[model samples]
Target: MKNILLILIFTSMAWGETPHDGMHHTHEEHVHEKFVDGKKLEVDPERFDKFIMDLKDTQIAIVNVQGMVCDFCARGIEKIFKKDINVKKIDVDLSKGKVLIAYNVAHEIIFEDIRDKILMNGQNAIDMQVIDL
Candidate 1:
């Protein structure tokens, strides 16, 4: 019975399903289909594609940043912003040193909050502005 249970658990995990359904494991890695410049493009795998797809009506808050030189830095930014209840999604453009945040206006998040978050994460915040999407 023990061996059979172990096998079942492993099999479910292998198939990207956990014993607990539709919660923790739902954020498993997945690609996105996007059309850009009159051509179809596979979205960046490094991005938080699942969260972005769930955006309904959001505002884009662009934060000019610095000191993000690697994948880990981008991931840190992604994780930090995603923690905010108001932040629906985040895209960290490492090359441009910018973090694009999709936030719901109901929470009344401000640029200062984002700037402080960046400072806490050891990244420099250069500028921040918002645009309705």
Candidate 2:
């Protein structure tokens, strides 16, 4: 019985489904370290201007996110936003703690939906700005 129990526990861990605090472990529960020792990346004004220029016809949403400290966090945000059909382009800047989303001009910006998606990625969308270009 003891060997059987040990085998079951090892198998569950190998499958990435180990129990934690009475709940099944999930990717979101994994901890991530800060990028660059938590130093904010300096934004180059010229590059930012180019990014805006490239999405001339789209409506851009600048979402200020919290807890976006690493590349993993950025990728999670990118994955969530890419699922939205209205999103034309998505960029996650961990240095600025922002998610820049270029949406189709015909689609209206939905703050609530954006907030929800960020939450799903284990981040908080604290503020948002919209610009039509």
Candidate 3:
């Protein structure tokens, strides 16, 4: 009887039905979407304003990213950029689906390099805006 019970449990698990399946499942109801130049983009204006204000006399890169749904995604992007000597600081906003990078005044803005770092974190860089402030 114990062997038979174990077999049934394993079968259920193999079929992708677990006891806690529904309990742990979560869905984010709020969809963050914006259209810029006929492309779907996600950004929070207030957050962007705040982020820009925090960096003084620095060049900022606002990268529109896809698949940044969790904190791990955010941290991964941050980690990759932090290794670059030109990057002064980095911030990832999952809600806005944007990665904000600050560079010193003399630092050059390289979109391909930024895209590569984001790609390393399993995300896509859809668009980028470089602001000289």
Best by lDDT: 3
- TM-score, one value per model: 0.56, 0.64, 0.63
| Tens-place lDDT digits, model 2, residues 57-102 | 6776767777789996578788888999999888777778877788
Off by over 4 Å in 1: 1-54
C-alpha local distance difference test of each model:
0.59, 0.66, 0.68
Error of 3 at 56 (Å): 2.2
Those runs of model 2 whose alpha carbons end farther than 4 Å from true positions after fitting are 1-44
Per-residue error at 47 for model 2, in Å? 3.8
Q: Answer with 1 or 3, whichever has the higher lDDT.
A: 3
Clashing pairs in 1: none
